[model samples]
Target: MHPTLAYKWQCVFIQVGKFANEVFLLLPPYLPILAGSLSLELQVLNLAAAIVLIAGKAFWLKSGRITPTDFLATLDAYIGGGTANQVRVAILEAFKDGIGGIGTDEWKEAFTQLVLDNQMQTAEPLEDREHP
Candidate 1:
């Protein structure tokens, strides 16, 4: 379940991370210890890295005038063929370039949704949505 969307959808049993055998990376990212209790989840870390990878791919995908969605929909391969990896990569890439290249309209919309999800996790909407 998405964070801000949690208010709208409860009783969810979301793993909040990679579900498919394919992972964005072979190893988890390194993290520095923080003061107090501040910490970021491994899922979020993977997402950050994935966005960079997806953004680069989206740049090329759109240049070819092929939406990631369309490309992914046509994939016909088995697990050994890395089909799951393809879906994971293409979906994230598609999200970044649905309307424009990475960091454009689609990226903005997705970032907005992330903020909204964060707000849903709290009682009142966060006045400060910016990251520290």
Candidate 2:
């Protein structure tokens, strides 16, 4: 992995770890105490549900798998306004090269330009289109 991407991944992992730690700290002993005092089975059940949900989400993130929709969205964000055929070919080439073929600075500039252009285009009046 490129140093920048590796750094980004590390930052994400750190954030996830902190979140999990905070969640775990809030549970367990507290649930037992609260459940015992209230004599409520529902509190225990809710705690169990929360644990399962958090565990499943953590497992999925650890698996390092990207969903198709996520991949498509990433591609669209990076390749906006490029010709479809060219985009397809570029994607293939990128996979073959095992590195991002575009320079990071260039990609950043293109993304910024695309966002600015989109904002301007959206702000244009519908009447302006007919005039052109």
Candidate 3:
């Protein structure tokens, strides 16, 4: 994998780790807890479990057991098809073009651009028959 690609994958996984930690921290022990009714014992147990699980997962992630190349290989396999390279190119170009990282709208436009650029569609746009 190229250095930039590897860096991007590492960044992606780091965000994943952050998200896991956030979710674990946010959830309460039980349904009643949301209503401000606390079971101290249950809360303690749930908090401990969450801490242990998050710690173990974080430890594994920081252990350096998995390299960026390995991750890229897995991702490439998951993406599949000859268009994997094309897709990557499209995404990189979109990023370069200043599309923000988050938001479905921007991503949708980027994908539409990719499709149009590739000439992937042959069909004409459908007309509204009643209006016609």
Candidate 4:
């Protein structure tokens, strides 16, 4: 090969080596940060999926189902804490007392009665309610 051509080739090789070395040197610091970012992203995805699942379950439970468990889930989600929770606890306690002896048909009857009782209470006017 010509001396000039050899020197040019040598210069190209040297530049390629320097570029490769720079890339390798930069990787050690960036790799951990990249890995950490990926890990955080996965964790965020997992949390989002869990939240979606919970919301979907609540929505499904509230979608006009007549099952007792579905009704209770809706009640809990809607009413939350305080007096509402007290009412829920009271209803559960009362139901549990006779639940062991009751069949499915009785459970439905009790639920219907409870709904009717609530409707009657809510349907009364304030003046009439004051007397009751």
Candidate 5:
């Protein structure tokens, strides 16, 4: 992938993460009262929230803004080799968890650590690569 395009997508992913966190935070206050007054269980409300979030992510996935190949390539840039594959798997799992559960700092840290620990796997020597 082109560096500029990849950078743009990286920013989009960051913004999506922020938006997901905001939605997660905003729902809690209203969920209980809304569900309780409707004579529904809290779990039902949570499920509904999950459905909405997951549907949004599914829409994004289906919209073709990011092709699977480009997504994998972008991930490979952050991390490399087999560990990148693992991170890819983790991303799929997160998708299953819903939008609010995806793209957290821990996921980014995992990629960063993989880059740090596996620098030797890349073409350049550790000394030649940019350090954080």
Candidate 6:
């Protein structure tokens, strides 16, 4: 992704993380009263809160923008083989040119080809039969 767009997304993620943290903090004080009055189990509420907090934290970390190492790793994964180094250099250059990064065309094309190939592979075999 473009650095500017990545930066923007990072800021947005940070804001979301802050909001989630505030919500998580507010949940604890109400837990006792909610559990007692609503006849709900304390364990269930605690578990749900824990899951939300963990997911929120993970999102925050993942959306904090990609580093150079991350970019290189991702490029390698997407364009594997002997051309990986060349692909990485090209991708970095594209990003530096403010080109908004690589498009999703390659991924979409790969997915489409995979589907077509699978369909062709699984097609029924033809058989010759005499008709009366």
- Report RMSD for candidate 5: 17.6
Compared with the true structure, what per-residue lDDT tens digits does model 5 show for residues 4-105? 999999999997787556545544543443233232332453334333333333344446453323332322333323433443344344333433432578
Cα-based lDDT at residue 106, candidate 5: 66
lDDT of 1 by residue, 29-127 (tens): 211211112223323432443344333343343464433332222221111234234433444544433333446775667655543332211122222
In model 6, pairs of residues that clash are none
User: Model 3, which residues run further than 4 Å from truth?
Assistant: 31-132
Q: Which ten residues in a row have the lowest lDDT in candidate 3?
A: 123-132
Which candidate, 4 or 6, would have the higher lDDT against the true structure?
4
What are the per-residue Cα lDDT tens digits for candidate 2 across 1-132?
Answer: 899999999999987677656655544433443233322433433343334333433334436643333322322322232322232343333334332334577544543443333221111112211110
Task: Specify the highest-TM-score model's number.
Answer: 5
TM-score of 3: 0.24
How well is each residue in 63-126 modelled by candidate 3, as lDDT tens digits?
6453333332322232232233444454455555445453478766665565445331212211
**Candidate 6 structure quality by residue, lDDT tens digits, 1-132:** 999999999999998687656555544543442233222332343233333333333333347643333322322232222222332233333333333222477534533343332221111211222111
* Tens digit per residue, CA lDDT, model 4, 71-123: 23332332322323333343454464444434478765765454333221121
Between candidates 1 and 4, the one scoring higher on TM-score is 4
Q: How many clashing residue pairs appear in each of the predictions shown?
A: 1, 0, 0, 0, 0, 0
Better of 2 and 5 by lDDT: 5
lDDT of 4: 0.39
lDDT of 6 at 59: 38
Clashes of 1: 1
lDDT at 16, model 2: 69
Regions of candidate 6 where Cα sits further than 4 Å from its true position: 36-42, 45-132
